[model samples]
Target: MLSDVFGDPATIDETAHLVGEVRLIRTVSRAEAQRTTRFVRHGRA
Candidate 1:
């Protein structure tokens, strides 16, 4: 669960509440992050 593109704290909290958990991390590139997240999300990583 990434939060950088989530925008605000309230939105983050709302997402967490609905989605169960959320985590934030620093990445050099948005594309890289998206790729990693997508991989993990599909349980293929």
Candidate 2:
């Protein structure tokens, strides 16, 4: 899964811990990547 906006290290770590295995890549824009990906977080912080 990917995020729409910027994803900080803490956020990535949290996700990784929950999912058990996750890799986060920082990107300026989706257009920069070949495959489209965006992450929208839940209401619970």
Candidate 3:
């Protein structure tokens, strides 16, 4: 299955998978939290 998805070893492009940095926030404002409250109740944004 690995060979079927990745193809040949020599032809694979490694640079295509470098996705840079990912940031995670620790806090949010009251308005921002209220906006997200509806999504939690209705299962959508």
Candidate 4:
């Protein structure tokens, strides 16, 4: 199963996997958290 999913080495500890998932979630969510509700492009016709 590990080979089918991860392939090659396919050997990560539970803590490492959890940390990777948390990092990815934070990275993906950071853009949304830092975005404003309005567009800011002006005076450029």
- Best candidate according to TM-score: 4
Off by over 4 Å in 4: 1-12, 37-45
The candidate 3 region of ten consecutive residues with least summed lDDT is 18-27
TM-score for each of the candidates: 0.35, 0.31, 0.32, 0.46
Q: How well is each residue in 1-45 modelled by candidate 3, as lDDT tens digits?
A: 555776875434442333221112223455578879978889987
Name the candidate, 2 or 3, with the larger lDDT value: 3
Ranking by lDDT: 1, 4, 3, 2
Candidate 2: clashing residue pairs, number: 4
Query: lDDT for model 2, on a 0 to 1 scale?
Result: 0.48
Which window of 10 residues has the lowest lDDT sum in candidate 1?
A: 19-28
Model 1 TM = 0.35
lDDT of 4 by residue, 1-45 (tens): 666665566354664688899999998788655553223344332
Off by more than 4 A, model 1: 1-3, 21-45
What's the lDDT for all of these models? Answer: 0.72, 0.48, 0.54, 0.63
- Candidate 2 has a TM-score of 0.31
Q: Give the per-residue lDDT of model 2 (tens digit) for 1-45.
A: 355443787787687676653223333344435333322233322
Which of the two, 1 or 2, has more TM-score? 1
Give the clashing pairs for model 3.
none
